[model samples]
Structure formats: structure tokens, C-alpha cells
Target: MANSDNNNKTAWQMATQVIHAGSGHDDPHGALAAPLYQTSTFKFANTEQGSARFAGEEGGYIYSRLGNPTTHELETRVAVLEGYDAAAATATGMGAIAATTMAFVKAGDHIVVSDAIYGCSFALFSELFERFGVHADFVDLTDADALTTALKDNTRLVFLESPANPHLKLVDIEAVSQILAGRDIKLIVDNTFMTPLLQQPKQLGADLVIHSATKFLNGHGDVVAGIVCGSADDIALIKGTTLKDMGATISPHDAWLILRGLKTLDVRMQRHCENAEKVADFLHKHSLVRKVYYPGLAEHPNHSLIGTQMRHAGAVIAFELDGDEAQSRYFLNQLQMIPLAVSLGDAETLIQHPASMTHSPYTPEARQKAGISDTLVRIAVGLEAAQDIIADLSQALQSSQQRWQRSA
Candidate 1:
């Protein structure tokens, strides 16, 4: 399959390709799976051939860091799924983001980004990009007008995360695209929350789509990987310049793990959506809950926009409790089934207190403005039975309420 030209295949057909796309006929020794080409360098047929490969006159692997048959297969599959001309795999999700950002923008250029992005991403834009003479402004992504207003003459990129981390805030991708349609700006969306099965950002006019494959793409919390999908020109530039110079490339073994994970993504996402809806419904009806933040809920502020942009509501849900930090901590400590941990989109349920755990880096005023209150708790619903998840949450809430009353 590594030798096959996949230019003609449709998207659904590409999912099938995920399993069989990367490997050539098995070795005569009968190895069924794609073997990890684990070496750093590849032997050249001749010096002339190597020169042609290096000069872009031909296509072939020269180094594992540059490209490998196994990683190439994952790249092709992700590209097709994302409806892009090409894709590149990275060692981690941050690697993908950094490579994509560095490829397009440089010193003196400005970036407009969502304020509620992954905490680390926010730190990068705020603390690091400034040191390199690249300026970034963070705004509430849900407000398209604010994003447009924040753009400057030097603004070269707009970075956003929809159904943003922990809070579940939705951004209007199409609206943002329309605002930038005639501008020189490129729109980059971190699509880790929705995956390509639910949201194809490129089809909606994004210039680039990135993912932390450690989440839903891997589906089992096993591998740390990232992917960037976009036009062939964009991918070629990043691959040739940023990726080559930075050396943050995905391992063949990790790529193979992602490939195996991709085979089950469709089915797992279905269950994740179904279970998340049930859990959200439960949270909405609880007496101690102040607000439930899941797009599947009609009361969600961006429900209509989400319906237009995404295939379904994603698995993450956040709710605010009736009290403060102590109440939130009590609930977290009472959970029996859901693990109190960070990182989402896994096989087992996980929960965290965003004000303390995920978004703790933000100043109090910043967290409050982003709606991450001291009482907010976020849940990443998994394949657990809905009844069981709800039951555990109910008990936790009950304990929290009692603790709050005792403290008062």
C-alpha cells in the first residue's frame, strides 16, 4: 500500500486505507503488519539517485526524521480524513502547532489567537512568541467580531480551538473564515476536540488543521503524537523548512500505534458522543449544578452554530457547582469511577477541576473571564455505562453539598 497512489480515493474509502495504506506487500517472511523502519538513515541506490531525492527531482525516503514509510502512511490517511492535499505527523501535538506557526509567521508578524486554548498553547503565544519578535493577541473566539477587530496590518495568522479545552466553548469557524476571506491571514484550528470525523476545518475554509493524536486519534491514551493537514504547498513548506530544521518528527512505532488506533476511531467516537450526552443531561438536572456546558444541550449559547459546523457534539462537558473551591475539591475527591486526571479523549472516563488543574496557570481574573470558575468541573466522558457515570457524579455532588453546608 505504501507504493499505491491514493490521489483518487474518497474520504470513507480512506478510513479503510488507514489499516492497509502504509505497507507494501508483506516481506517474504510473512510479516503482516507494517514493520517499523527504525533506522536513522537510508541507503541510496546510487549517489546520483540520492542527489535527485535531495534536490526534489524524485520522491524517496532519506532519513527517518525526514520521512518513513510507516509515518507516511499515517500522514496520507490523516490528510484524506481531513480533506487536505497533504499532511505531516509530529512527535507531539505542540510540535505540530510550533512547526505550523513557524512555517508561516516570523519576526515582526502578528497572530490572533483564542484566549481559551490549551493552557500550554496560551503560554507559548503569550510568553515565548513575544521573545522571538512575533506578537500574539488572545481574544474570546466565540465572538467573531472581537477576533476581526483584533487583527492588525501585520497579522498573518488566526489560531483558534473550537469547543475549547475544559470549558467547551464553541467558535464560529465559518464566520471567522468569512471575515478573513480577502485578507492575507491564514486560519489555523486545533481540531483535537472534534477529530476529522466530526469537524473538517479545512472544508470550512481553514488554512490548516492540527490535532493532538494522543487523544481521540489514539483513543486509548497510549501514544503522544500530532498531525497537521493542509494544502500540498503548505505541507511541503513546513516539511522542508520547520520540520527538517526542528527535528520534531513522529516515530515509526508511534505512527503504527496511531494507525492501529484509527481503525476504531469511528466506533469509539460514536460511543463517546452518546455517553457524553447522557452525562450532560444528568448534570443539567442536578440541583447543585449552576450551568451545564455541552453543545448537545439546547441551552448551550453556541448550540445553533455548533449544529451548523460540527457533525455532533463532542465528548467533553463542563458544569459549575453551587459553591467555591472547597466544594469543587470535595466532588473531585468523591468520584469513584472517573479518574481525577488531566488530558482527555480516552477509553475510560476522566474528570478534573479546571480552575485548579487544567487552567490553573491563568490568573484569577483571566480564568473568571473565560468562565472557568472556582466551582467548574470538567468531564471527558468515555465508554463507561452512562448510568454508572451519572451515579458516581450524583454521589459526588451529594457529598460536596453536605461538605458545603457543614463549612457554612
Candidate 2:
């Protein structure tokens, strides 16, 4: 996790890094992938080594909570990809956000958050942190004026998510970083939607990058894990305190599953983008669809940032049907291929109505201002053939039209 010259020498291109970053599998059995060291504790050579490990005098792990080899490998690879000095793995994406934010704040601290984010993330601030004497303000990150008015003297952290959940809104990272350059605020960006492979938030001036490894990072949607990447000092603080005290460490087996997933991230993302582009076009042209919100579309407000900050338009698509919530539910029921599911970034297509499902955690007023209408449908396009995805959606759109065609 050191950012010294020795580490720089090992730095490789991202494709190579995913395969070889900090990978020293010295297992006596010579297994190919990282072996699962699925125990709760590690043994030392002697009592002296244990004392040194505890005192930070030695470099060996004393317990799984402090460190684990398999998890460390995943952390190292993701940190390298994120262009950070180190990383910490957690039980879930929320765990990563909690550990990172809790490490930097306490009672009497104030934080600024994006107006629209993943529902659980909103809950993390409103339901959990606010009860503990911390204060948070949700503001529109796309507007410079809003960002200016939200900053306070006690502001300790500024959290955001670009191409925010359920909506495709862009926050200019460089512009915002310059605004807080002289302040002591830490900018935390949830980079779950755009993996570091697509967008490098560190290069754009973020203090820390958080990810729900359950999403694009794992690509296959088999494991639920989280990672926070930043400087060695910052990562060490979370590992030593928040992660240990909160007991949100990821299991070694899940870490290994995610590690396997990372190896193919680049190719999987390429296919995801390819499939999303075609699906967006189909939705945009459909008579029953009102508006499509994928960044790949030229009409998107943040379309230009896709090529500038990210490698491509991601696989998530948000659109409103020309119907009410009940008609939207009818459309979901008529779908033949895409599953009506909550979580995204799976190998198979998944769809959900956010206003009633994912983003329901937000108050009605908050959800309305964020533009998550009751008829809004969020689709996580998968690796299915473009024709298959389009065909499934087309039939559902037709059914929805028949079910809701009236008065309008």
C-alpha cells in the first residue's frame, strides 16, 4: 500500500494492472487465482512477531479484521486501477461509504451531499449520521450556484456521485475541486456507476473514491462487496478504526469472487456500453417512451462528459413511460426477458421502478425535486444480444400503451 518509488516501478497499464497488481501468490500449492485464506486470524512465527505486528513494527497481519491476504489482493488491484495509494475492503457498498465518511467526521461535523444519490446513501446521511449530531445538506451538484450556497465553515466532507443513481446528471469534478481548493474539505465521490476503468475520479481531484463492488466492478453481480481507495494514511485510518470497530470486513471467499470478476472488467464494460447504446436508441424512438436518460444519447445534459471523464456511456438507462405508475407496473409485468429486480450491474438484464422501489427512501418532496417521477423506469442493460434486449422492451412498450392509452 506504500506510494513510494518502489510501488511506481510496479505500476502497469490498467488492463495489465487488473491481472497483476500487487499479486504475489506465494501459496505453496501454486494455485493460479488468489487462494482463499478464509480464517478469522493469522498466526505469527512467535510472540515477538505478534507484538511487533500489534505495535506497527512488523508488516504481518495479526487478524482478519486488520488485514487478510485475499482481501488485500483485491484492495491492491482496485487501488491501482483507481490511481490511489491504498484501499480497504468492506462487507457491502454501504459499509465502504460508512467507514470512509465516519473516519473523517464525528459529532458536530457538517457534510454536503449530492441532491440525488443511491437511496441507501441518502439514508446513510439522513437516517444514521444525522441522528448522531452530524448535519448534512443535499444540493444540486450540477449547478455552481447551489454548490456555493451549500458550503459552510464547519463543512468537513463533500460527497457526490456523477451520473448519479436513477438519474444521469454530471457534476463537473475539476470545477468543484477548484472551488474548495483552499478549504479543509474532503471530496468523496461514489464511483459505483462508473468504475475506475471508465472514470478516474482521483485524476479529476477527488480526495476519496467509493465503490459498490457488487456492481460493475464485480461485473457478474455474484458478490456484494465494497471498496474505498485513497492515500495510504487515509486508508490505514479506516482500516485501523472504523472498519475494525464497525466490523464490516468482507469475507475472504467473497473477496476472491470479486477478484475473479475484476480480471474481465475491461471487456465486460465494453460489451455493456455497446449494448446500452443500442437499447437507448430503441427506447428513444419508441412511441410509448417519453424521454431516455442514457448519456450515450446526444440529447443528454451530460453527454459530452462521457468521453471526457469516462471511457463510455455506462449500461444503466433511465426513462419515463407515457403512463402512470400503475401502467408502468403493467409494463414490468409484461416484460418477457428482462427481470424485474432491484439491484443492477448483473450479467442478465434487470429493471425496476425507482420511485416505488430503490429511491423510495427519499421523501416525496426530495424525490420529486430529483426528477424521479412515479413513472420513471430504471433499466440496467445487460450483456444480452442487442436484438433480444430491444425485442423484449418493444413488446412491453406496446403492451403498456394498450393498457394506458386514454384521455391524453
Candidate 3:
């Protein structure tokens, strides 16, 4: 596969970009779908060509680990969609995070991370990086004053997620970018929850934008991959350093699946947003639900950022049960349709308890400080009919509340 001239045009809308971007169908047969080059290594035309490729005097791929046509196409499509100069696909969401961080930061450098982020990400910064002498401060990035106060001369990077994981708390990306402006500190955003359809962090002044392609990008739960988009220079630095050395490259097959998944992303995301809003509304009005954390609700603390920061309130929703952890477990068990799973952005609705599942990497004190409550439940609303999902929730909540009453 080769780059398509059509993909470079900025005028193409996102829907078209998702389908046609990075696809020239330039294979020998001119296949409408991009061909997957699954081989581990590419044969050189000759010894001279192979040496030239290794010496950077040539342009074609020499190794799949270094780069694959299939993965390259995925990277290009994502880069164009994200409005970045370049991109790199990784084996997992954590691989993307690790490559991006390791490419830029060194030992003794300081990083400021959102107090609320994905559970494994918290562990990566707090544990893995700490052993390397990289210090991280988990700060409330939603607080502009706190963000400003937390930055030090040694601060090399600031990382956060908008509509953050498990809790759905939001960070003001533009404001945080401005605070770090001219300071030479890189601002990295994990855009997994929003997807490029709902938000473009680069448009907001972020230096790099990353996604767990495993989630909404794949839309189906079958694949696990990730991508990072940034300026060509930054992406090159990453590709040359940690991504190349650590070798967490995405497989060609997974890249192809993500490409297949991308074609339906626009429609899937619209459905997800619609379904999530309906579910959030239902949860908000339920007597058994203590509080809803969806930004789509008018009363949500970060609802004001919707139009300016993100196109819509995304698919994931987090809420507190009007009961204890045991009651929360009872409600989860009573549910008949939604599966109790960790990952989101699938065809079927999925739910999880962050404190006990995803965010368990944090200690009890850290989890409390991060606002991941014991009774909080997160759901990735699926493509099912809105009424059906709500009915399922209603029955489960009613049953759990009745059981709690009986036990009480």
C-alpha cells in the first residue's frame, strides 16, 4: 500500500476521511479495500536497495516491526482524522502511552498528570516511571489554579483525559494548553473516550493526541490497539526512539481490523452518543441512582464545554448507586442484558466497577483522592435501542433496591 493523494486534502469531511483516507487501493489488483501486507519482512530489490533503505536513503518499508503497509495506512488515516502531521500505531493503548512518554521524557524529569485517568495509566506514571527517576504529580487538572500551581521548572509533560475514564470527569484541554504555552512543556491528551469524531485535541493546542484504538476506534471488542498523533517531527522522534527500541508495534492483522472498523466509526459514534444520552437521562431520574456523571446532562458540572471542546457528550457514563458496594454488586448481578466487562465501545452494552476493576491499580487512599468512589459504576452505552437499555437498567435497579430493603 502507498499513500493516497486524496487523503492529503484537508477539505474532505470526517465521514469521508474515515472511509477513504490513506486508501488508494493501490495494490496490483486495485482492490477497493486496502490490502494487508502481513509478512514480517519485505524483500529488497537488491543488496544495494536494502542497504539504502537501512541507511535512510530509500523510502519503502524493510521490516514489519519497523513499519508495515497495513499499519502505516492506519497511522496515516488516524493522523489525517486527528489533524496531525503524522501518527504511529502501537500494540496496545498502553504501548501508545509508553512510546509517547518515553520518547520525550528522561530520568529526573517531572510530569503532571490528571488526578483522574485510566487505572493502568495511573500505575504507569506512579510506578513504572518512578523507578526510572521520573516523578509524577497527580493534580486536579480541572482546576486551572491547581494546574498552574503544579507546574515546575522541571515539568516536561502534562497528561490528561477529557471526559476521563471510569469517572467521566472532564479536563479543560484548551485552558491547560494555554497554561503551558511558551513553557516548552508538552501537553499530551488521551482522546480514547471522545474519539476524533467528538473532539480534536490538536485543534485545541495539544502537542500530541492519543487513542486506545481498542475501544471506540475499533467499535468492536475484538481488537486491542492504540495510536498517537502529533507533528511529523515529534512522531518521527517517537518512531526512532521508544517505539523502535521497545518494539510494541501493532500487528498488521489488527491494523487491518481497525481499518475495517474505522469505516463504520462515524455512524457507530453517533449511535453511541445518542444511546448514552438516553441512558444517562434514565439514570438521572431513577430513585436508585444516587448521581449521574454524564456531561450530556444539563446539570453536569462540565456540561458547558460540550459544543466548544467536544461535539457531544460521549458514549461512556458513570454514576453512583444510591446504596453500598454490596448493593452495587447486587444491581450488577441483577442485570440481564449488559455484560460486566472492562473495555467499552462495543456493539453490546458493557459495564464495570472502576474501584474494584479498572482503577484497582490505585491504593484505597489514592483511589479516594482521585474521586473513584466505591459505589461508582461506569457503563459504555452500546448501539442497542435506548428504551431496551433503560428497561434493563430499571429492572435491575428496582430489584437491587427491593433486595436491599428486605435485607435492611
Candidate 4:
């Protein structure tokens, strides 16, 4: 059972927190697992109780949209993992991004963003934020001078991703945080790739940490969710306004699924890193592979920084093909075991061509600027035996090279 008290989390290690962060949960039926409290509405004892709950004077559920005991369990556990005062879950990973943006900035504000982020995030910043009169500047955050030059007086937030998506470019969270320390700007980190098991952004001075819970926190690939963890005051404002008004709260069942997945996070990540290291080494030696972007590889520019921030090199790897996009697509199509897919962090190894798929939103010029090439292939290495994973990739690369040579 959970302690229901936030302090209880500080006493246990991460592995223990997954099972016990929200443990003191109670149900009329006395079920040990967090009860699903599936209904939409809760009864108020009286007018005073109802008013207090709405006013934030008391803690109780009035509506599932606003709060639910089952969802709260997941929130508490995630908050503890991210080392934040509070967490809010959303209907989907993108919702977390949307809610956080809406909660923080408004018209006339500017944002300095990193170049290597999710495709949808780029769209939200470039398309949606632009329409609202809010401005955004996308720069290679690895270049500290560029980041500093891009910042404007009206810059309301500095958003970044460490070991960024697709290419694995890392932004120095502590360095960036210190730059904003005396300023009024908030520093938000998209911590989806590292998961708290490997890195805690808040501990490194991030004001808020966001996760695509759909990818990792719900590791089974069966649920779609997102989490934003931050100070209690900020989360309360987001919960009451942005999430509530936008109707992006997570479902109780999805929250429970994430809670279940959290239990084995430690073990899963350990294996993921182990398998990824071997797979990266294999790709590096292969003739058809041009370059591999994984922090574990000493060749990776951010290799040293991984040791500074993350516990492991992480599971996803992006590599360029010695051939063109056609060969890359052929390589993906030739894979027998690992499925060609979009989303990452699944129990099964998933691979995809980022140029034609995840990063399709960018034009050829924009893609190059973002460090994504047409021949780039991303592998979300899963928990399969490292040998088998290597075999599948080896055969696929060979097949693609042969086909390309014959065509040439």
C-alpha cells in the first residue's frame, strides 16, 4: 500500500517507488491494487464540501476530468520518478506538449526552442504558435552561443530535449538552466527519451519535465498518454486551466496501465541499454552503415555528456545509410523480425526511416538543417536477444546494399 503522503516517496529507491509511491490507496472493497474509480463524477458530502473541493481548500474527487483517485496514483508515482512536486497526465503524449505550451505562454511572447525535437512539437511551435501571435526560434541548442543569441527579451520559455529525438543531439540542461537562473523564463525539458530511470531533468535544474508516456512510461505500446511534472503551483495552474479548459485529462484505465508498466521500468531499461550497446557496435562495423548516432558510442559527439546526465546510452539509435533513400526504404522493408513502425519504446524492436516517416513534416532543406538525412534510419532497439537483433539488421543491410549495387 502507498503512504498517501508525498514524503513517503523520498525514503524509497526508484524500484520501490513504482510499487509503493501511491500505495496507501484505499478502496471500499479493500483491493490491494489501486482501484479504478471508473465513474465520471463523485458525490459531494454537502455544499461546503463541494465548494471547498472546487476552491482547492480540500483534496477529494469531484469529477474524473478534474481528478480521480486511480489517476492520482499514476501522477504521484510519475512525480516521484521525475523528482518533481507534482505531475499531470494527459490523453496523449502530444497533449502534454500542447497543454504545457498553452499553460505557459500566450500572445506576444517568444520561445527559443531546440532544433532536434519531435515532429509534432515542431508543428505545434511553427504552425499553431505562429497563428496566435506567439513567436518561436528553432536553433541547434548544442551551440550555446546560438541559443543565447536567439533569446529575446520577450522569451517566455526555453524548451529543449536532451539526446534529442532521431539524431540524439544533446542539450546541456544544467548549463542552459544556469543561463536562465536569474531571469523570469522557465526551462522545460522533454525527458521522453531518457525516462527518469536514466535521467531526472528536474534534478539538473529543469523547471519542468515532460514525457511521452505513450512511448516509455506505458512500455507495452498498449496505451497512449503523456506526463508533465513540475512545481505544485505550476501544475495546479495547468490542471485548473490549460488541461481542464482544453479537455486533455488522461483516462483512468490508461493511468492504471502506466502504473503497471512502471513496476519493471528499472529492469526493462537495463536490458534496453544492454541490447542497444551491442546493436550499435554491430552497426558501426557494418560497411553499409555510414554513421550511428547513439551516445553510448565513443564516436558520438555527445558521448561524454551522456555520462554527465544519463545513467545509460538509451535504447534508440539513428544511423545513416551509405546509399540513398531508396536503399534506406529497401533496408526497412527487408527487415524480417523487427517491424517497420513509427512510435518507439516498444517491447518489440521497431525500426523506421525518419526522412520519409517521422520527420516527413520537414522539407529537404529543413531536414538537413535539423541533422536528419534522407538516408537516415532510426532503430528503437527492444528487449530481443542482442544476437537476434544484430542478425536481423545485418541481413537487412546486406540485402539493401546488394539491391542498390545491382541497380547501379
Model 4: weakest 10-residue lDDT segment is: 1-10
Give per-residue CA lDDT, model 2, range 227-275, as digits (tens).
9999999999999899999999999989999999888887777788889
Q: Answer with 1 or 2, whichever has the higher TM-score.
A: 2
Clashes of each: 0, 0, 0, 4
Task: Please list the residue runs of candidate 2 whose C-alpha ends up more than 4 Å from where it truly belongs after superposition.
Answer: 1-12, 405-408
Task: Please write out the lDDT profile of model 4 over residues 1-408, one tens digit for every residue.
Answer: 112243224323776876777667877788887787788999999999999998989988999999998899899899988889899999998899899878989899999899888888888888899999999989887777887888888999988888888889878898888778888899999999888877888878999899999987788999999999999999998999999999999999999888888888877877888999999999999888889899889878777776557767889999988877877888889999999998888899999888788888776777888989888889998989999999998888888878887888
Candidates 1 and 4 compared by lDDT, better number: 4
For TM-score, candidate 3 versus 4, the one ahead is: 3
Which candidate ranks first by lDDT, i.e. highest?
3
lDDT (Cα, tens digit) per residue for candidate 1, span 299-349? 988898654577788899988887777777888999998899888889999
What's the candidate order when arranged by decreasing lDDT? 3, 2, 4, 1
- RMSD versus native structure for model 3: 4.1
For residues 45-68, what per-residue lDDT tens digits would candidate 3 score against the true structure? Answer: 899999999999989999998999
Residue pairs whose backbone atoms clash in candidate 3: none
Residues forming the 10-long window of minimal summed lDDT in candidate 3? 1-10
lDDT at residue 305 of model 3 (Cα atoms):
85
Each prediction's whole-model lDDT (CA)? 0.86, 0.87, 0.91, 0.86
- Candidate 1 TM-score, C-alpha based: 0.93
